[model samples]
Target chain A: MPTSLAPVSIDELKAIAKRIRAHIVEMVYEAQSGHPGGSLSAVELGVALYWNHLRVDPANPDDPDRDRFILSKGHATPFYYAVLAERGYFSTELLKGFRKLGSPLQGHPSMKALPGVEMSGGSLGQGLSFAIGHALAGRLEGREFRCWVMLGDGELNEGQVWEAAMAVPHFGLGERVIALVDRNGIQNDGFADQIMRTNPPAMFAGFGWKVIECDGHDMAAVDAALAEAERPDERPRVVVAHTVKGKGVSFMENNPGFHGKAPTREQVELALTEIAEGLA
Target chain B: MTQAASAAATREAYPYALIELVEQGVDVVAIDADLSVSTMGYQFGEKYPERWYTVGVAEQNMVGIAAGLAACGKTAFIASFAVFLPGRCFDQLRTSVAQPRGGLNVKCVASHGGITVGEDGMSAQAIEDLALATSLVPFDVVVPADFESAKQAIVAVGKTTRPAYVRTGRPKVPAVYGPDYRFELGKATVLRTGTDVTLVACGVMVRAALEAAELLAGEGVSARVLDMATVKPVDRESVIAAARETGAVVTAEEHQTTGGLGTAVARVLAETVPVPMSFVGVDRYGTSGKWDELLTYFDLTPARVAAAAREAISRKR
Candidate 1:
């Protein structure tokens, strides 16, 4: 039902990656508002996750048996929105109304407004604890759905994040939890290393998580790393994805200034050109 | 006090009552920040091992994790010293539990409030806890005066769909109600009636207020003693009627005067009918000493309440 990408070669994955990136840029350009930068950086990670790993139902979003995906760092929600739309969770035309008045998209993912969002997460560092709650509930109730949370490396500075990190492994909430750290080393202020340098992998590994490193821009590498996370064990796995701040566009790449900025009309045209050409 | 048939003090009866919610097809979980035994969540944890979590001496995480569990349809109770759960987890409780939809039924049972913690000094005594917990987003703050009221508070907190905090005292006090006595959330019971003065009190202090009312009668001041059990969503109509009938008022609680019964009573009186008022409570923290010595240190005895009532009557003129 997922188009069976496992036996399909790297070239097929790249083609699907291009289609997903096209969906991302076009959705952002049509809306004329959204954080295209963070969305672009997480393209490959999104393709790797949604297309492969997560067991979900586009028809039944609230199915308790389905795996839960929590986006703690919510700025990149446009990418998730695009993926959800393209996957037939909703109509593709709804993507044009993102961040508009009375739209379900409230700039940040709200579980109250959106169907697929597991928890409200505009404020960082709180979702992981909530994920642990769901994971623990599933474990206690003997449900089979696993929990996945995609976190921003910048959000690691918040104290509650570490409290959650310390807690997840301490509970030994197995394959039940797979944390994806989008380590682009960027935050709202500036480069995270300059602002507050976080040692994410080592810290999570020290806390009894099985660690995996991968190039986030490479879809194949991301899928491989996420696969390694499925093995049931005592350790909760952290897949630290080394990514650029704005991965796709040549001008916006590695620029922290693009963190929350939507593209100007002229800028949108140029971004669409660059993304379309890169895909081609 | 008991000769033959002994009943487990209401504090001892709490966890046993809590386990029933789990059997009723609700996920009742407990989080104790290293005070499980004192808080009575220790027995609950022992009875339901999979449902209990010892938050390892951290009250903040205990609150946050409770919020998390409540988010996922589990009713979690944070059992701890009144000072830490409300004081340490104040912000998390406000942002997480109070703001959530259908109101996160995250219950908090604080074992000790006021100088009744005793012997642990000012650090462990949660004199101002009731006041602080009442200020949260429309929270139900229940200060159960006696044993039956204490058990009802725990069960009522689980049944009510709001953020509720029930503060229970440490020492084994006399039972206030019978085995099947029902308790309402915001309604106050008129323990005794008189015309000259109205004394409002809750928690372990209500017994003292009732005693003080008897003493006030001897001094030619007939006082109406009311149990203002639920602090927030306070029994305002009864408080206003008391103020209307009795020209003077004295509010007593095992909490600071800032946001407890005194402040709530004063607000209602100010808006409806202004009455002369005095408050009897812990103005400062306690030092490590015997329970009576600590209550004495805070001036929370019945004599102090009677004095405050007399003073309030004198101020009414």
Candidate 2:
């Protein structure tokens, strides 16, 4: 049994990632309207952060010193909800109610609707700025809480994201904030390069952020990168996690059609079976 | 009416009021989009450097950051030109600020609210801000009538947990409220009372409504002047009562004829009393000129308000 203070091993983290992917497919299949591709792409990143680094207590979620995790790419709520539940923030029973009326499980993460959500997010590119706010407030109050925000590679197209990228270093809040970018390489319309070539590592470096490139699916590499990110630095860090769009499922890999489309009954069975086999 | 002794821009009182909030032991954080000087946010920044943030001309980022700060249990106040606030970052306000049920104590105080932002051309003016702000769910919109009211309005919103939008103007205007006057969030102040016509006005137009009431008095037309400081959740009881008593109504504002104070008052009147009404506001885009000159050019004047009152009263029979 992994205690709260005990570190989760890389193999256990990988097993947890597979379960998260399975939950994503099942939840999206239940909702019949959710973004599965981005959610699947970010499963490993969520697992690594929640299982290893975040100093959060599910019983006392409103702890002022607890590290905040913002889903900047808000459409990936299934990934966020799964990880949060697995961490004991809420019961996994809520997963079936994703995007349903009067459910805490909204299509996008609503901070007010759930106990552990750090931001009420849906419209893209605003989450990083909000993370900066959390960091700034923590700095002023002399709190050591860190802010970890996850961003979609496709969401880098928004001008507001760049604005936040520029302001974090100027405020000297670089060390207090960590941005995780899931480089899925596919947006809603087509390939991310065709929509906008945001070479994130180069772009974030230009904005004076410390950039780290890692293979997202590899649990050990992601854990190592996150650990390295916690090292004292004068600049904000961006971990560009290179990931397949529809990770863990064969047919949906790098497929743009699965970006926001619901999987058919047969596809759901196949995807869940594939995710379950990954755990085996 | 309070003595119009000296004139001061409503924007001048904003920063001082922000400082007062901190002095009162509120955890206040202020952010500006590189318009601290123009928006008068520099005074607060000067006093509280630790809690001040300048986002360097990025209005969208300023709003998003303000939401984040508010989420962390701070009363985050964001300021910019009225155009840039609801103008440039409407989506940020809708999603990040207004949509949050909890952790949404963001006070978006926009300076240069209307066509009074003259000499800077149409781009700087925010004639539709009140409309845009009032459209959002649970946003308490306050358009202060003068310097005293502006300060009091800021302090009122600073002390509350609800998300609010308070608008201030660039040009200096005569003081309408005294130092002792208290500003309620969703209530209107009756500046003058009469029986024939009720003139409802907001922001700088409250003074115009008062002046119109005086003019109407001269022509044997008794006009009731209502200072509708809060544009959203507009003083419905006052509006309904005035419509029922006066039988005629005229709405005045330094905003567009559509979806402003006029629209707010009209909704109340149509629902309850259904009085004859006329709207006195700008229907065309503003042109470059002096601040007061633009008010006259856009027909947002005392004479125009008085004329609108006569039209509504004439149609009452």
Candidate 3:
């Protein structure tokens, strides 16, 4: 029998991503709520960024010089909270309390409720601007930390996204910032193409960014693209990571109906079993 | 002769102060919504090519972009017509900048604040910018009266840790404070004082309220004049004393009564000790006219403020 099947190479890191996914499933099943499709799709991206890139000290979150990250498409916090938990920013047990009353982890990220969360965002097309502010602040202090923003492909339909796109190059912050697009074409209503079509990499290129494409499910590919982003360059990089809406599990893969729906107990058991077999 | 002399002597100084900041390696980022010349952001951009960022005509993006730079710990100064920054970018500012505990020190150098923005007409004038910004969390509002104060306000914005809006205007109004004057966020400055009535005003109306106070003094009415520059963390103590001691309050501004200085003063008086208060501001839309004519149309004149104060005092008994 094969020893492992998860895309991440480091066993410890792979286990961390798995545990995050398990928590995501556990919380969604417990709350009888939360979006799993996009959450599942972005698990790798969030894990990759936080584990390897984002210079966060779960110990001193208020450290002003820490690298800034904004989840522009903020609904996928289930995926992010899991990473934050495993990375020790908060208790891993807090995952089960997701969406409960007074839980620091809310249905949407809130700046006031939680520590280390940079901003309260469930809105789209706005975080990039905040990221810009963080980057600008970093420059002011001559700080070395980079600012990263994760956006969904569906939010590309928002005209405000292009507004940020046009200004990124003009500010000469090409090397200081990185924007990643979770290119999972399904949004809330329907398929991105059937709803609104945008070639993000090409669009970003037109806006004068250095664009890179990678298989989001492949950890090595994602890691490589991110590493390349840190190189001394004059253009802000955009990684167009082609990801599946519901990755890993069988029934939910590429299914639009699961956009914001959580799995039931029976379905959760089935998913766990399926994921276990994939692990084997 | 006094009124005529004040009008000719007053000068517009926001752009020059911004240039001074740029010269100080302040890294000031100025943006305009395609109306750079009108907003005066274009002037700063021209002088400081490296620091200036004309983010084209997108007002929402302009604010969003400024917020992004602020997040990165940059001192971003965004300039636009009052109509667009607060009017069009309420969502960006609310969610992105003000909601976050530490939104980058992005200052909204909003020009055409209140009804003083002429000709571009009522649509361009941002009569609600102060109220909208002050109502949000973690935001400090400043309405400077003259050129030197505007310069000091911009420098102060850099040192303060919260998001700020330094409201200025198109017309060159009289300078109530001279060149060496200092200002702070959330602190009220007493311009002139009297026992009959307290005249509280901000922005362009500060000078008008001062004029009105002088006029009231001529009519045997003692008026306490205050420059309530910072509207958000409004100085409740000073405002309360003005209401208690003077027994009447008249708030003059180039804005609407709903969220402007009038409502703010009324709120303070109601909680402290209920007293008679009247607001002198634009209660209706303004026509496209010269800047002076528009200010007069809105009844934002010292003469009109004196009348409002007299009327409020009469109703006090």
C-alpha displacement of A55 in model 3, angstroms? 5.8
What shift in Å separates residue B94 of candidate 1 from its native position after superposition? Answer: 3.6
What iRMS does model 1 reach? 2.5
Model 2 DockQ reads 0.83
Q: Candidate 2, residues A1-280: lDDT per residue as tens digits?
A: 1223468999899889988898888998899989989999998888989989887888888988888898999999888999988889889998989999989898988875888998888899999999998888888888888899999999999999999999989988877889999999999898999988889999999999999889998889999998888787888899999999989888889999999988989999999888888832
Q: What is the TM-score of chain A alone in each candidate?
A: 0.92, 0.97, 0.93
lDDT of 1 at A210: 88
For B188-307, candidate 2 gives per-residue lDDT tens digits of: 998899899999999889998999999999999999999999998899999998998999999988888898889999998788899899998877787899998898888888999999
Error of 2 at B213 (Å): 1.3
The C-alpha stretches of model 3 lying farther than 4 A from their native spots are: A1-15, A52-67, A111-116, A136-144, A224-235, B1-12, B15-51, B102-104, B179-184, B214-220
| Model 1 quality (TM-score) | 0.86
For all predictions, the C-alpha RMSD in Å is: 3.8, 1.9, 4.5
The candidate scoring highest on TM-score is 2
Estimate every model's Cα lDDT from 0 to 1: 0.78, 0.89, 0.77
Model 2 alpha-carbon miss at residue A86, Å: 1.3
Candidate 2 residue A263 C-alpha distance from true site, Å: 1.4
